[model samples]
Target: MPELPEVETFKQYFESTSLNKQIKNIKIKDTRILSIEENIFINTLRGKKFNSVTRHGKYLFVECNSFFLVMHFGMTGDLEYYRRGEEEPKYSKVLFEFTNNHILSYISTRMFGKLDITDDYKKYINKNRLGPDALTMSYEEFLMSLKRRTTNVKTALMNQRIICGIGNIYSDEILFRTQINPLTKINILQEYQLKELFTNIKEILKYGIRKKGNLATYSSKLIIPHRIEEENCPICHTPIKRYEILGRHGFFCPTCQKEN
Candidate 1:
C-alpha cells in the first residue's frame, strides 16, 4: 500500500507532469474500481480542470474549486504520464487526457484502489474519522493521542483514527528507531521515550518523502534494506527478527528493541 511518503511523492509527480492543462477527456477502462456511476463521473470531470491537488494521510485529493476527487491507492495504485501514440501503460484503470494531447494514467494491478468525487472533502474526512496527517500533526497532539491508547505501541501508532498516514511498514520503522518493542504497552513508555518516538515519526516520514519513497535510497540503518537483503542489522549486526503484530509483520533488532 502507498503510505504517506509514497502518496506525497505521487502528489509532487502529478503537479510536475500533469497540472495546469485542461482535461480533454476521461476514460475508465475498468469499471471494477468505479466509486460513482460512470456517466456521473464522466460528466463531472470531463470538461473541468484539476485546479489543485493535496494529500491527507494515504489519500490524494485532486481539487477543482469546491469539488474534490479523492483517491485511495489501495495496495498498488500509481500514476503515469505519457503522450499520444505511445504505448499506454499496462493495468491502467483510468486515463485523463489533456487538451494538449498528453495523458495521465491511474494504474493498479489489483482493483483495490477507488476514485471518488465529493463537494466537501471535510465532510468526507470527518465521516471516515481520519485523524490529523502524520507529517503535519503537532508533537503535543501526537503525545496526547498515544497517551489515551492502552494498546501496544505498534498498534497505537498504526491506528489511523489516532494519527493517520502510518501503516504497517512505517510503524515498524518508527518503533525500531525509538527502540520500543512492538508489544510495549503505551502506558509503560516514559516521557522521554514518548518524546523520542514523536520526533522519529516526523523525521523518518520526512526522510521517506525526501527519498521519493524509494526504500533502496534509505539509510543503511533502516530495517527496509535489511529485510530486502535477509541480512543482519546494519548498526549492531544482530539478526533482525520478524514477529506478527495483529495481522502485520514487524521487523526489529532483538538486541536494540527488547521488550519494555
Candidate 2:
C-alpha cells in the first residue's frame, strides 16, 4: 500500500504535471475505481484547473478552485503523465486529457483506487474520521490520540484514528527503531519510551519522505531493505523476522524488538 511518503511524492508529482492545466476531458475505463457517479466526476473536472494537491495519510486531494478531487491510491495505485498519442498504462482506470496534448492516467492494478469530488475536504476528513497527519502531529497531540488505545503499541501506531499516515511497512520501521515489539501492550512501556516512540515516528517517517519511500535502492539498517534478502539485522546481527497482522506483513529483528 502507498503510505504517507509515497502519497506525498504523488502529490508533488501531480502538482508539477497537472496543476493549472485545463481539463479537456475525463475518461473512466473502470467503474469500480470511482467513488462518485461517472457523469458527476466528469462534469466536476471539465473546464476546471488544478490549483494544488494536498495529502492526508494515504489520500490525495487535488484542489480545483471550486472543488477537490479525492484520490485514494489503494494498494497498487499510481499516476502516469504521458503524451496523448503514447500508450496509456495497462491498468489506467481514469485518464485526464488536457488541451496541451498530454494525459494524466490514474493506474491501479488491483482496482482499489478511488476518485471522488468534494467541495469541503474537512467534511470528508471528518466523515472518514482520520486523525491528524503524522508529519504535523505535536507530541501532546500524539499522546492524546493514543490515550484511547488499549491494544499493542504497534497496532496503536497503525490505527488511523490515533495517528494517520502509518501502515504495516512504516509501523515495523518505527517500532524496530524504538526497540519495541509489535505485540508490546501500550501500558507496559515506560513514559520515556512512549516519548521516544513518538519522536521516532516523526523522525523515521520524515526519513522516508526524504528518501521518497524507495526502500530498496538505499543501503540502510532498515529492515525493509533486508526483507528481500532475508538477511541478519545490521545492528544486532540477529535474523529478521516477519509477522502477519490483519493480513499485512511486518518485518522486524526479533532480538532487537523483543516484547516488553
Candidate 3:
C-alpha cells in the first residue's frame, strides 16, 4: 500500500508534471475503480483544467475546475507519468491524457484503488469520517487524538479514524524508533512518552521521504525495512526480532527498543 510519504511523492510528481494542463481524454480500464458512473467521470474531467494535485494522508486529491477527485491506493497501486506517443506500460490501468501530450497513469497490480468525484471535499471527508493527517498533526494534537481511544497501541496507530496516513508498516517502524512496545495500551501512554512518540513519528516520516518512501518494497534499489526478520539491527547491531501484532508482522530490536 502507498503510505503518506509515497502518496506525497506522487502528489509532488503529478503537480510538477500534470498541473494546469487541460484534459484531452481519459481511459478507465476497470470500471470497478470508479466510485461514480464512468460516463459521469469522463464528462466531468474532459476539457477541464487540472489546477493542482494535493494529498491528505493516503488519499490523492486532484483539484479540477469544478470538483475534487479522491484516490485511495488500497494495495499495490502506483502512478506513472509519461509523454505522448510513448508506449503505455502494460500496468497502466487508468490513463489521463493531457492537452500538452503528457500522460498520467494510475497503475495497480491489484484492483483495489478507487476513484471518487465530489464537489465538496469536506462532505466527502466527513462522510468517510477520516481524522487529522499525520504529517500535519501537532504533538499535542496527536496525544489528544489518542486520548479517547482505549485500544492497543498498534490498533490506535493503524486506525485511520484516529490519525490518518499511518499504516501497519509505518506504525511498526514508529514504535521501534520510539522504543515503545507495540502491545502497549493507548490510554497508558504518559505525557513524556507521547512527546517521544510524536517526535519519532515525524522523524521517521521525514527519513522515509528522504529515502524515497521505499520503506516497504520498490523495484528501484529494493532496500527497505531496515529491521526485517533475522536482519541485523541498524541501531544496536542486535538481531532484529519479528512477531505478530494486530495480525500483521511486526519487526523490532529487543536490545535497542525495550518494551515498558
Candidate 4:
C-alpha cells in the first residue's frame, strides 16, 4: 500500500509533471476505479487545466478549474508519465493526455485504487472523518488522540480515525524505532515513552520522505529489520521477529522492543 511517504512522493511527481497542463483527452481503461459516473467524470475533466496538487494523508488531490480530482492509491497504485512512443504501463487504469501529447497514467495492478471528483477537499476529508495527517500533526494532538484508547499501541498508530497516513508498514517501523513493543497497551504507555514515540514517528517519516519512500535504495540498515524474515537485527545482531497484529505482520528486534 502507498502510505504517507509514498503518497507524498506521488504528490510531488504529480505537481511537477502534470500541473498547468491542459487535459486534451482522458482514456478510461477501467471504470471500476471511478467514483462518479463515467460520462460525468469524463466531461468534468476533459478540457480543464491542472492547477495544482495537494495531498492529505494518503490521498492526492489534483486541482482543476471547477473541482478537485481525488486519488487514493489503495494497495498497488502508481503514477507514470510518458510521451508519445513510450509504452503505457501494464496495469494502467486511466490515462490523461495533455495538449503536448504527454501522458500521465494511473496504474494499479490490483484495481484497488480509487478516483473521485469533488468540489471541496476539506469537505470531503471532513465527511470521511479522517484524523489529522500524521506528518503535520503536533505532538499535543498525537497525545490527545491516545486518550482513552486501550488498544495495543500498534493498533492505535494504525488507526486512521486517530491519526491518518500511517499504515501497517510505517507503524511497525515507528514502534521499532521507538523501542516499543507492538502489543503494549496504549493507555499503559508512560509520558516519556509517549514523547519518544512522537519523536520517532516524525523522524522515521521524515527519513522515509527524504529517501523517496525507497528505504532499500538508501541503506540496508534502514530497512533490514522490516524487509527480511529471520534476518539478524542491524542494531544488536538479535534475530528479528515478526508478530501478527490486526491481521498485518509487524517486524521488530525482540531484544530492542521487548514487552515489559
- Please tell me which predicted candidate would have the highest TM-score against the true structure: 2
TM-scores of the models, in the order given: 0.95, 0.96, 0.91, 0.95
Best by lDDT: 4
Candidate 1: regions farther than 4 A off: 228-230
- Give, for candidate 3, the lowest lDDT window spanning 10 residues: 216-225
**Model 3 regions lying over 4 Å from their true place:** 216-224
Please list the C-alpha lDDT of all candidates, in the order they appear: 0.86, 0.86, 0.79, 0.87
TM-score for model 1? Answer: 0.95
Give the 10-residue window scoring lowest on summed lDDT in candidate 1: 222-231
Better of 2 and 3 by TM-score: 2
For 102-188, candidate 1 gives per-residue lDDT tens digits of: 999999989989999888887878888888889998987787677667899888888888888998888888988898888889988
Residue 207's lDDT within candidate 3 is 71
Candidate 4 structure quality by residue, lDDT tens digits, 100-161: 98999999999999999999999998999887889999988888878889999989988888
Please list the residue runs of candidate 4 whose C-alpha ends up more than 4 Å from where it truly belongs after superposition. 223-226
lDDT of each residue in 1-260, candidate 3, tens digit only: 58888788878878888888889999998888888999999999999888977677789878897699888888778888888888886766679998888899988778888888988777777788887788888876787788778887878888888888988778877887677777788898887888888887787677777766865443211113554677777666777778887677777678866766
- lDDT by residue for model 2 (77-123), tens: 89899998898889999999999999999999998789899998888
